[model samples]
Every structure is written in structure tokens, then in C-alpha cells.
Target chain A: MSELLLQKKHSSYYYVKSKLSTGLPLFAAIFLVLLIALLLLHFIWHGAPGITWAFLTEAPRNNNTEGGIFPAIYGTVFLVFIMSLLGVPIGTATAIYLSEYARQQSFFSRSVRFGVNTLAGVPSIVFGLFGVGFFVQFIGKGIDTAAQTTIWSKPSLIWAAATLSVLTLPVVIVAVEEALRNVPQDLREASLALGATKWQTIWRVVLPNSLTGILTGTILAIGRGAGEVAPVIFVGAVYSLPQLPDSLADQFMHMGYHIYVLATQSPNAADALPLQYASTLVLLILAFSLNLTAAYIRLRIRRSHK
Target chain B: MSSNSTLYKKSKFRPFEAIIEWIIRLTASFSIIIIFLIFIFIFKEAGGLIFGTAKELKPKKAVSEKVQDKSEEKVKPEIYNPETGEIVKIVEVKKLVKAKETESQSIWANLFSDTWQPVGKKPKYGIQPLLIGTFKVTLVSLLFATPLSILAAIYCAFFAKAWIRDIIKPTVEVLAGFPSVVLGFFCLVTVVQGVYSTTQFLQPLCTNIADIISWILPFSDRWIHSALTISDFHYSAVVGGIGLGLAVIPIIFTISEDALSAVPNSYREASLALGATESETAFKVMLPAALPGVVAAILLGIGRAFGETMIALMATGNAALFSWNIFHPVRTLAATIGSETGEVQWGSLHYNILFFLGILLFLVSFIINALTELFVKKYLSKKFQGA
Candidate 1:
């Protein structure tokens, strides 16, 4: 009877200890998830009421305290559009070279991979510094000197887009490479067996299958480029612009920059709170939806392959 | 068959395909070129300062112009009162100028000093305070994030059911999607207030604890008195650290979870067979097996927090004060560059210093990444292969 009692007590103690250990981690996980959910809900609750059609379409009238964010939205779209046009082709071609052409351990491919990793790790602010140094001072000034004009020697839409494309290059390349690799070896072998050249096989068989993936990569890159404020701060982003940019050289307002300005530099932060929340909500929706769509497509692709 | 042979003969000399291949190959080298350009351009701006050539311009011109203007004014004064005006006065001014020239210190002297007043009459560019602030914030964030993320990873990897794991994983992914600026804004508006209230509430209890401790350990009274005081709370390193912690948690969690999951299933089975419970098996067997990856995750997290700009900028109050107190407002290197690079004249000393900070950030991250890639990753591969 004594032995049985001791064993029962020991087992109960063990059970409680295990339960407590498990509970601790569970509590941590729940806490993290709840905090994020609360943050999102807070934004939506505060921002949803202020987001109207007028808010989306009209310009601010009283020094950015009473205007819609239409110009910011327009600038963001234009910036992303130019970034995609510049970055997507280069990234896709690089991915193709890495996946299809390079041998397993070539020095050239190894160096390229190293470059991509380092680029990805480089801070966004460093990218901003590099943009100012290379694009604005060196290349832009060089162009002005050649043309005998002052058009390209300052922060502008083209330089910002160019800087952003460089910043987003790693994202595009990684995504496209993953998608290209998902093309089956059998398909390429079959194409080659049919007397197709390597390029012809890749073009016909691999590229078609991975078209959705390439689109996904582009969307992901655009999403990332759109949300970035640091790289654009020195390159092109302005606090306010009276009108939308008329040319590549024109300065423009951006949504991320707009949020930053509203949050930090507003005359009356309390009064600007509603607009700030609304702008954040819009940007959040834009980024999350783009990421979600890309994720959904990636999931579908993986499932189809399986 | 004859047409097929003729086509094959034509395909053998296809210059178009050759050109296309060459184009693709050239495009592959774009990233390499861009990386090189980034390094070159950033260094080129700072090269004058690095090589002691920046001092050759602007300051000399300004000084000589001052002397010329002074001479012109003195000429009229001397003409009016030739006896009163002594030539020794001009010699004295020249001697003072020479003394000022000798007083101009090296970059290392300026960098090692604690003051960071870069826009004053006598601009001091001591980077020590910025370095300390960066270290303190990074430390706070690492302390806040590492354990919480590891525990969460433990839950997701070992304890949670598949459905729960799925939910938690996606939640973390969504959190990762929040941009750094948004996080900074959230910190500025929400977390700052939250910290203030919480510290206000805890102040009495903390003071009591400090009082008791100081009484017990009499020698620590002064230090405890200073450390325990939370009279007011505002934008501070602790707030910024928490904000950065928020950004870093998902990174650490994801990588840690991956590392934990990468442990071979055989180890779990063996641990179970040895009568170890689920938590014991995970804590003792899986965690140890995945130690290298977790360390790598942490190093990467530190790198991320160190270089993060917007959060440090908007939340830390952008004050470059050298203080050990977490409640004191601080500035980081990245934030310094982000906030100041815009207003500074191009190629000015401030501009060059900001680039120098950039180079420091770049080198640190490079070394961290190289360490992870070359050492930890190799060790992990070896360990898993041996398993």
C-alpha cells in the first residue's frame, strides 16, 4: 500500500510538471498570435471609418491634413509598374541561367549566388545611400553635364524606381528560380528527345509551365517594392506634391512616404491620426493581398506538381 | 529525311541562338555588377575623408577668405590711425590661424570621442554614442525576442497538433509581412504609450525592490538608485527595442522552427523509446541537435535589428545620447544615416561620415552572413549527414 501510494504521488508530480512545461510554450505562442491579431484589428477599427471613395479620389486641401491619398496611390502604382518593367526580365533571365544553364559547381555561378545573398542582406538604407551616390550624383550628374541641362541631377521617379528595382532584385530571382526548378526533368528530356535545342526546349516546355510562377514573382517583387520607404527616401520620395508626376524626372509623393510623413512630421499628430490609420490600412491591404495571391498561386503550383 | 538533314545542317550554324545565349549569360552577371557599383560609389564619396583630402577644400577657402576680408577692413583702419594700428596684430591673427590649423584633429580622434554635435561651429563627430545606442537596442531586442521565439518554435515544432501548427505558422508569416515603417509607426503611436503606462504602474514596486536590495547590498546603493528610477516614460531605447523585437520575432521563429523540424525523426523515436516524454524528448534531443541553426537564426536576427532604420528612427526619439538606462532616448547608426543624409550637403563631412557608418554596417552584416554560411551551415550539413 505504501509503495503504490509513492508511485501514484510521483506520477502526479510528473504529470503536473509536464503540463506546466507544455502550458508555458503554448501560452507564449498564443500571446504572440493574439498581439498580432490585436494590432491588425486596431488598425482596421480606427481606419475603416475614414476610408471613403472621396478619401481615395480627392487631394488634400489644407496642407495634407484634409486631403485624399489619391496622388500617393498613383505614385505607388507608377513606381511599382516601372520597377517591374525593369526588374522582372533581368531577374527571370538570371534565374534561367542559374537553374538551366550553370553547371553544379562552376565558379561563375557560385559568385553570382554569393552576390545575390549579399544583396539580400544589405540594408534598405544602404541601398538609399548607394542610390544617391550612384544614380543622383554620379550617373544623373554625368547625364546633366552631357546634355547641358539640370534634368537628371536630382531625386526623381526614374531614379527611385531604379533603386527599388535593385533592392527587389533578390526577391524576384529567388522566386523565379524556385519556380523554374519545379519544372520536371522529364519534360526537358522529352523536349530534347524530340530534336529541340536546349533553348527551344526551355522556351516551349519550362517557360510555359512556370509562367504563373513568374507572375507570382513579379507580384511579390511589386508588393515588396511598394511598401519600401527607406530606399526611396533619398532617391525620389517627397513629403508632398501638388500634382502627379508628369515625367520620369518629376518628384512624386509615395504612400509609404506619406505614412512616414503623417506619423512623424504632421503639424498636429492627434488630428492626423484618422488619416494615418486609414493610409496604413490601405497599404496593409495592398501588401497583404498581393502576398496572399502570390502565396495562393505558389500553393496551387506545388499541389499540381504533387 | 532529306529536308530534316538540311534543317539540321542549317541549325548547326544558328547565330541567333548563340547571341541569345550570350545575352542570357550577360544578364546573369548584373547582380555582381550592381554589388560592385554599390561598394565603389559609397566609398568614392567617403574617399576624400578616408585619404585626408576632404580637408583640402572648403575650410581652406573659408579661412583664406576670412583673412582677406579682415585685411581689407584693417587697411582702412590703419590708414585712418597709422600710429594706433600695429602690424603685430595681423601677425597675431596669422599665428592664431596657424594654431587652428594644428588643432584640426584626425578622423580617428573625432570618431572615438563621445560627442556627436556634427552641425555646430566646432563640429564633433564622435560615433561612440551611436555605437553604444545601437548595441543597447540590439541587446534589448535580442533579449526580448530570442527566448520567446525559441519557446514558440518549441511549441510549434514539438507540442502543437498539425492544425494548430498550420494556423500558427501562417500567423507568423502574416506578421512578417508588416513593413518596418508600419511597425515603427505602430511603435511610436501605441507601444510608446503602452510602455509609459506600464512603467508608471511598476515604478513604486520597482523602487521598493531597489530599496530593499540597496539596503542589503550597501555598496550598490548608488547604482540601484539611478537604475530604478522611471520618473517619466517617453520615446526610448526600450520602446525601439520592443518594436524591433516585433520585427525580429518572426525571423527567429521561422528559422528556429525550420531548424527544429530538420532534426531527423529517428532521434525522436529513439528518445521516446528511452522512456522520455514528448517535452523531454524535444527539449533534450531535438534542441541540442538543432543548436547550430538556432545560433545562426539569432546572429541573423541581431544583424537585422542592428541595421533596421525606420523603427530605430521613429521610435528611439533620434537622440544620440550615451546612456545605459533603457528609458533614455537613443539613436542608432542606421537611423543617423536615414534622418541626416537628406539634409546634408553632398560630399560634406557629415555625408562622408554617414557613408562611413554605412560601410561599417555593410562589413558587420557581411561578416555575420559569411560566418553563418561558411561555418554554421557547413556544420549543420555535416551533422545531418552523419546522422
Candidate 2:
């Protein structure tokens, strides 16, 4: 480096330009920090005082102006739980198909990839509409007509979770596919050479190795499902439900939807301000923690692989 | 153990394995099926509006007409029920299927107007305002996000020290995980207010260009104000756009950063060895080399912004208005779907229009995604094949 510097003897103009260039990264990093700080500050300023154990656990009173958001929290968890339960299997299977089974350049694989990509690009609101059209009005109403009852004809938790599962399908598929692709081909060949069938090799080796990735995908989907509001809006979520949903057919409260209702539909948006912020804070915490956990797990897995 | 070994030998051609494989393959195809179903259902529902129903045949009216038409040659067609082998009741299914009266006006004329009143005496389904709103928010967000993210990406890829790169990359990527709803909430409750106050503070200093224009033309100042403000210190496109910018930044940064980092080390070495400073090397050499990929990143960012729903719905004041000004509230197609889908009557013109909007959003995003993929692929090919 010193020899090169001696050979080059750069001009002062070039030196000043390089010095100024360093500022760009510094400026960018500082901007990011500031944005994060501002978000944190807003949450702390409005949400801190209102965030009590009771607020976290108790049901709201006074048209949701007062009391805790226990139901909303529970509903969000349950919704994400259902979404992951249904989404992960298909997503993982698709990942396996793409990674291990389908020839990459084949039309089937390409179309599957295209489907995943297009699904990812579809707006969440469209998913909501799809839920209303396919799940509620069509399927739900069909169930009602068949059973001669209206029990299955309305928006419910199952429909919302199903909608969200589809919405998060790409996230899981991409994550698990990346994981499955990372599994060494040498191990698979070795396993096959040892007389294990393709299925056995995948089951005993590839899936076990990609466990972290599957979990990462599940965690990311949970975070995404928990925070999404549009797909749940008409399909199931309500501002206030009589009780926590005991069955998939029941409507439920959600933190994101609660915040929306408080912000937009509350008779007194001002009175609900603190509670709204608190719900937003809770939603942010839940989502960020899920994402951070996924990231941390991925980091650990990468480190271990190294 | 000997018996189990024999059993395993007997099961060499495993039916269980075949079944499992079939199940897995079926599961893998679920997404394709759902995508097809989504397209089918949305279009079918929208078909009610596209091809309006043949007039209402109320049960009472139908029965009376059937009684009257029974003697006529052009009577209502009927057939025996397959199960009962008898003529069954003909259920009339024709209410709520009025052909849109826009027959008096051309489709282009109706769609290009300023009003978006969908449920009044004369329903005007002018999509012009929605398009303007969507583009306004999208353009504003892109204008803010693309440069910042690209610059940041460039810095991270080429300029940042090791520790800084390690810290910055993950943190910024984590920002992508923050749901648009949360961002929308923050903007609605906090950021928009902040922007409003800042705008107020700068109001005196920031003279409106409209002021000059209004002086030249004899238009009312309120017209400019209406263009500028839904009201002072309220939700506006600027706030929604900035919120969208926040949502868009992570996407652009992540992709552009990858592209920048993917540039061969040889280029950097050559540039640096040529007596160019690191910044000049980055700005002149690395950036231009990664330009296609960066452009792809920007396109994907635009797709994200265009299709984003919750943030715009929560922050854009949900007003369907036609205005060029950034200060006023603007309604986006995704937001309209989010806010209005519930209230709209099923199979109504309003309902179908929302789905039509969804189709429009879907097509735009589909094109953008395809283009981005093409650009990124070209960039990758160029990188590897040295085109």
C-alpha cells in the first residue's frame, strides 16, 4: 500500500474527494439510526404510561377507550398460530419440491416459482378481497346452505388466518427453499450411495439440517401475519368481540385492527390516543421481536455452518 | 431383528414412500392452485359488473309472468328436475344486476372525471383521481427512497468499514420486517403530526409557487390552498408518501447493496490502482457497473410502494380526490380496497370496481416485478458472463 501510494502520489483534489466520500456512509448510517430512534421515541412517549399489566391482560371497557387489550393480543397470537400451522407445511413441501425434486429449468418449477412470485406481489388488500370472495361468500356460504344454517357464512378467524397463510406463503417458501438449497449435495449423494432412498435421505438428513431455516421461515411468517391488517379486515377482525374466540368460526379482536379502529372509527379519537399508541407499541414489539428472533436464529445457524 | 430386516427387504419398493412423495407434490402445487383460484374468483365476481344481469325477475313477478306466459309460445323455458322428474320452482336470481347507466356516456368519459362518488343518484366511477393519488404517493415515496437507499447501499457496499457494514446491513434489513401497518400507525399518530408541525413552522419561509401563479391568473388563493391542504396540520400525501418511503427504503437498500457488493473486486482494485480515490472509484466505477441492478432495485421498490395498502389506508386520509399538490390527502387503489371493501354491497358495481382496482393493482405489480426480475437477471448474467 505504501509502495502504491509512493508510486501514485495522488493530488489534493482526489484526497479531498475521498475524505468527502466517507461522509456518505456516515450520513446514511446516522439517518437510519435517527429513524429508528424517532420511532422508539414516539412509542415510549405515548405508550409507556398506558402499558400496565392490567392494560396487557384485561378486556377493554367504554367502547375500547379504557381497559387492556388482552383479547387483541390473544387473537393476534392465535391468528398467527393458525396461519403458521397451515402455511408452513405447504410452504416447506413446495420448497422441497423446488429445491430437491423439480428440475429448475422445467416449466412446472418455473410456474411454481412464478406463482410464488406473483402471490408475493399481490397486494394484501387483494388477498382480503379474495378471502371475502372465496372463503366467506363462496365457501362459507356454501357450507351454510348445505348445513341449512348461517353459522359458517360470516367472516371468522379461520378465514382471516387462511387468507394470511396465503399472503405469507412466499415468505416461507423462499426461506425454506434457500435452506434446502444450502444443504450440501455431497451429503445427499453420500446418503443415496449408502442405499437410503431419496425420501429417506431427505427426511433423515436435509430436513433435519434445514430445521433452523424452517423455523426462521415460520417465525418470519408469524411476524408478518401478526402485523398485517388488510387481509384480516373484512375476513374476520372486528374492533370489539364479545369474548376471545373459542373456535375458528368466531370473529376476534387484533392489535393491528384495534389500532386502526381506534385511530379511524373511535367516536373520540383523542380519548383513545394513549391506548392506540400503546397497542401500536405492543404490535411493534411483537413483530420486531419475531423478526429479531428469526434473524438471530439465522445468524446462529450461519455461524454454526461456518 | 431378523424378521424386521426381512420386512425391510420386502418393502424395497415402498408404497409409503410413493404416497408421501405424491402428498408432498400435491402440497407443493397448492400455491399454483390458490393463485389460479384467486384469479378466477376475482374475475368472476367482477364479471357481474362487466356483463350486467338480464333484468330483475322477482319471485312474485316471475310467478305472475310464468302464469301469463304459460299460454304463450315464448313461454319461460322449463325442464323436469333430474331427481324428482317433475317441473321444479324456477328461482329468480336477478336483483342488484343493473347495467351501469354509463351507456349514455362513453366509458372513457366516465372514467376520466374528477369525482369518485360510487353510491349516489348518479354513480360516477372516475378512476382518474385514484390513479393520480396512487401515482402521487408512489412518486413521492420513490423520489425520497431511491436516492437515500441507493446512496446508503453504495456506502455500505463500497465505503463502510467492516464493523459498520456488519452492524448496518442487518439492522436495515430488520427494518423490512416492520409491518406496513405498524409504520402506518406510527405515521398516522406521530410522523404525520410531526410533518404537519414542521410544515407550519416553515410555512412563512416556504412561499408557495402557487402564490405567484394565482397572482398572474385571477384564481382564488383558496384554490391553491385546497390543492395544498385538506386542512392545515392533517393527514396528507406527504406523510403517507414518507411512510411509504420508509417502507420502500429497506427493499431498495437490500437489493442495491447486494448488487453493489456483487461487483467484482477486480474493478475496485483496478480503479484504486489507477490513482482514483475510493469515493471516486465507488461513484464512478462501482455504481455504473451496478446500475442495472440498482435500477431493478428501484423498480421493485416502486412495486412495493404501489401495492402497499395498510400504510396508505391509515395515513392518506382516505379521500378520493384529484390534486397535484402533495399536501392534500390522496387515496390510493390499495387503500380504497382496504377501506371500502367491507362496506360495499356484494356483487354491486362498487364491489366489482374495487376488484377491478385489484386487477389493475395486480397487473401493474406483475409487470413491475417481471421487469425487475429481467433487469436483475441481466445484471447477474453480465456479472458472471462478463457481457
Candidate 3:
């Protein structure tokens, strides 16, 4: 009993020493937290009622004080919607083909997986170069008149959306593949026993089981695609415009771009404060809503599956 | 008759299914097409700049013969001033040709060029100053970030109390959520300004120089003694690099900690059983075991440093001049692209020249990342039993 108590006391001593050693990470974390708090304080103090409903609805003009980010809101939403619409279908289909229809060790599938991972790590700026080269210069050439404008005519929203789809393609493939890999094999066997073909079994049993995961992954990809400034700047000439684009070809606005401009390129240089914060708040809200909706959809699918 | 019955009896349409499969296959193949096409696009735009204006004026020692010969005759030396023994006396002829080669070599030579004064109407797009500035800043950042990040991660994974670990991990991750632009703004308004104000107290710390040594000190007492301030050229790369380092440390620590945590439990237990101290196990056994992931994290940090634009763009003194001093501000390739891209007419010499810079950045970063993923992953980790 005495020996055990002595050992316990010894452990207590080491625990305190361990805590002392932990000081570095703890201090670094706390320092970061303190800086973050200071930044938020600065933001809130300078921007309260300025983050108004009016600010959200108004079009920016006269140094941005007289207008809001109506166009940007629409553009950001449309960008996310269109990118997700295109990216989800192709990525999910590819993931399905890779996971279900092919052997994992096959040369084709292995090479495909390798390409996808490498693509994911390629930098955003590099993607911008690619988009400008392929989408803007080459692909955009065929779609529009060469002398459409004095300069090269800007590629429309359709081109931007398509290019962004390519940029996020690897991410979607990785996500959906992970989701498919998690689905149980027993469900596939059960569906196959019911006289369904491999395609039908995969669609009905395996896909539905993983649909929630697929939705979540798609939402994450869209959220990421929307905020990206590099590729969009290269492929999409979205910035300040008085009117909202009626068609995909017309120049539009994006909340992320709006924040970037207000902080960097605001035409109305003096009043960038309220505009930057308000746009940031809107972006976060949009991202959160998209994620939450996907979560909600996932839950609904789970409940129905059960 | 049998095939017709197959089509009519079932709505499944096997041929249609085959067509859809073909479509999907095309889409899969399309990914490759996109990558290949992108490379083609970058090289096409960048080609005119790198090849040079004329064959005779092309780089004396060609990296390749064909590339040298194909250069436009515009840059070839047609006139000379043997009077002063200058190879090319007429600046205008060379100006036009050098403008095209300025796409790549101009800035590279600028890295070694002694003076930063823009010649006459157009400044030759020399990059030596910016390259010097970038390296100095990056070196400082590594100095600030590497030791702190590695040590903090080691401390957290090996020594932290469980309760503290949970709190520390999440908080550090939340730093990733902060937009990089915001970090730049913060550094500009606060860190840069703070350093400027403190310049008064630091002025006395300058090293004393005798008459001959004065020439070697790079800057005189007047510049060092002046109040720290911000303008286009006069600024601080030290602050910018440190600020960037702070922004990147979380990335390093997060990955490094994961590497540390993933170290096999048996190694720690064995070390402990052998009467090794906690610090010894962490530094010798666990760290060695975790070296692969640590290497990955370090390489990731380096790649990030090379590519980061917004903070460096806004904070680096924006002087496209080369200086060895750590305190003086400098420009990075990323900053140059950001500042010049908007102004340069798209598809013109200046514009193509900027793209050439992008090509350099892409090539350098791509090589680093590829090496890390390909070579370091196998060799470094295996040496430590971490791969």
C-alpha cells in the first residue's frame, strides 16, 4: 500500500513537470487567440449598424459608402451553385466507377488515383495560369469572336464556372471516393440477389447509402470554389459593375472579390472599413449555410435510408 | 429481327448505355486533356519572352541551340560603339530586343545588377533587387518560424497534459481560418508600425565602423538612425518575413504535431523503459520516428513561403532593388506579379514578362513539391523508420 502511494506521488510530480513542458504550444495558442480577439474587437468597434440590411442590398458606388454588394452576393451564389452543379455529377460518377466497377490494384485505377492526388496539391496560382492558358486563351477563343473587343473579349461566366469545375475536380473525386469506400459490401450483395445488374445494384444500394456523404463532399467543394480568387480572376473578369449580369456571359460580382477590392482596390478608398467586414460576414454566412444545408440533407437521407 | 426485339422489348437501351459510358470515359480523359492543354498555354505565352529578339543577340551560351537561333533578329547586335569599347552603343535597338528577353533574363541579371535606378524612360525589368529582397526576408522568416514551430509541436505532442492538448490543438487550427489578407493588414497596421516606432530605441545598437569599414557596412548611420517609416521603397523586410512566418507557423506545427503524435507508441514505451527522460524520448526516438512527416511539413512551409503574395506584396517595401541588409524592405516575385499585372497591357511585352515570372515561380515550387512527394517521402522517412 505504501509503495503504491509513493508511486502515485511520483506520477503527480511528473504530471506537473509535463504541464510545464506543455507551456510552449499553450503559449503560442493563447497568443494567437489574443491577437484574434484584438482583431475582432477592432472590427466590431468600427462596424456595427454599418453592417446593415441596406449595405447588403445596395450596389457599390461613390466610394462604396452609398452602395452595397447586391451584385457580389448574386455572383458568389451563382458561382457556387453552378460549380457544384457541374462538379458533383462528374466527380461522383468517376468515384463510383473507380470504387465499384474496377479492381483497386488495377494499373488504370492506380494511375487515376495518383493523378487525382497530385492535382490536389498543385497550387491555386498554378491553376490560375492553367485556366488563363487553356480556358481563356484556347477554349475561350473558339466560343467568341477573336476581335470581339479591342482587347481579347473576356470569357463569360459559363467559362469561369467550367474552369472552376476543373480546378475543384480532384477534391471532389477524393471526397466521393472516400464516401464510396466506406459503404458496406453486404448491401451490394443484397441488391444483387434481388436480380439487379451491377449498375443497378450500385445505383440503388451503394450510392443511396453514400448519398449523404456525397452531398456533404459536394457542398465542401462548392464552398471552397466560391472563395477562390486566383483562378476566378484569371478565368472570370468579375469586379465592380453597376448592374447585375442577366446572363452567364455578362460580367458579375463576387463577395470574396468584393472583400479583396474593398481592402485592396476599393474605388471609394476612404470607406473601405464597413464594406470589408460586412462582406466577410456575408461570405462566412454563405459558407455556413451551404454546409448546414448539406448536413441537413445528409440527415434526411439517413433517416429515409433507415 | 433479334436485335430489333432486344431494343423494343426493353427500354434499357444497351447501346444508349454504351454511349453514356463513352461520354463518361471522355470526361475522365478530359482531365488529362485539361492538364496537357494548360502546360501548352503557359509555354505559348511565355515562349516569346524567353527565346529572345534575335539569334546573334541571343544568350552567348545557349541552354539550347534551336531556341537561341529562332529568336527574332530584332535583338541581334547591328550597331556598335567601339569608341568606348561598349559592345552595344545604341540603347534603343537593344531596348526593343531586351524588352522581349526581359521576360526572363532581365530580372535574373537584375538580381546581380549593382544599381536599381530605372534607366531613362523605361526601367529594364530587372529582378535582382526583388530576388535579393525575397531571399533576405525568407531567410529571416525561417529563422523566426522553424525553431519555434518545431519546438512548440514537440512540446505539445510529447509533453502537454491531455486537457491542455485538446485546447491547444483546436485554437491553433482556428488560425487557419483567418484569411491571409487579414494577416497582411494586421501586420501592416500593427507589427510594421510597432517596429517603426521602436526604431528609436534600436538606433544605438548599430555596429560601430572605422573609416575603411564604413564603406563595407552597406548603409550609413543616417539611414539606420532615421525613424522607421513606410513608403514605396523605404520599409522593412524583417517585419514582413517575421509576420509571414507567424502566419505559417501554425501550418508547420499542425503537421509536425501530427507526425509527432503518429510516432509508434512502442518506441516511447521502450524509451521510457530504458530510463530515458521525456525530453530524450521526444528528441531522439519519437522525433526520429516522426521525421518523414516533419520533413513533409517543412517542405510544405517552404513551398508556401515561395508562393505567398498578399502579405509580402503589401508589406515588403516594394523596392525592386537588391540589398543584403535584413532590415531593409524588398520585393518578391509574387509581389512583382501582383503590382505589375494590373498595369501591364495584357499580351504585351510587360504582360508576357509577368507571366514569365509566374512560370519561374511555378517551376521552382513545382520542383520543390515534386521532390518532397517523390524523393523525400521514401528516403528521409525510411531512414528514421517513419516512411
Residue A205 displacement (Å), model 1 = 1.8
Better of 2 and 3 by TM-score: 2
Over 4 Å off, model 2? A1-22, B1-19, B54-109, B206-233
Model 1 Cα lDDT, one tens digit per residue, B33-125: 998998998888777667655764338656865885787686545544466655655665667666556545356688779988889887788
lDDT of 3 by residue, B1-387 (tens): 011111112336567545655665556655556556656677776655666532322552343333334433434564456577665634554464555555345544643465443334544666677677768777777777777788778878887789877776656654554445555655655677677766654544433323234456546535643422222233578777877786677778888898888777888999999877787688789988788788778777777776667667667777765567667778887777655655555566556666777777766665666666764456655655633
Local distance difference test scores for all models: 0.87, 0.81, 0.65
| Each model's chain A TM-score | 0.94, 0.90, 0.81
The lDDT of model 3 is: 0.65
Tell me what TM-score chain B of candidate 3 gets against the true chain B: 0.72
Return the clash pairs for model 3, or none: A58-A68, A63-A268, B53-B72, B54-B72, B107-B127, B110-B128, B111-B128, B129-B321, B129-B322
lDDT of 1 by residue, A1-306 (tens): 879856864897877987877788898899988988998998899899989999999886686778799999999999999999999999999888888877646788778888888888888898999999999999999999999999999999999999999999999999998888887677877887798886787789989999988999999999899998988988889988878998999998899989998999988888888999999999999999999999999998888887
Kindly list the per-residue Cα lDDT of model 2 for residues B1-387, writing each as its tens digit.
011111122236788787877888788888889988888888776665555531211233445445545524332355446788765443322221122233332444665688898778767879988999999999989988887888889888887889989888877866787778778888887778788888887675444665766677756676764554434738888899999999999999999999898889999999999878788898899999888889988988999899899899989888887778788899998998888888887767678778888878877887887887778775576675753
lDDT of residue B31 for candidate 1: 91
DockQ of each: 0.48, 0.41, 0.27
- Winner by DockQ between candidate 2 and candidate 1: 1
Q: Model 2's CAPRI class?
A: acceptable
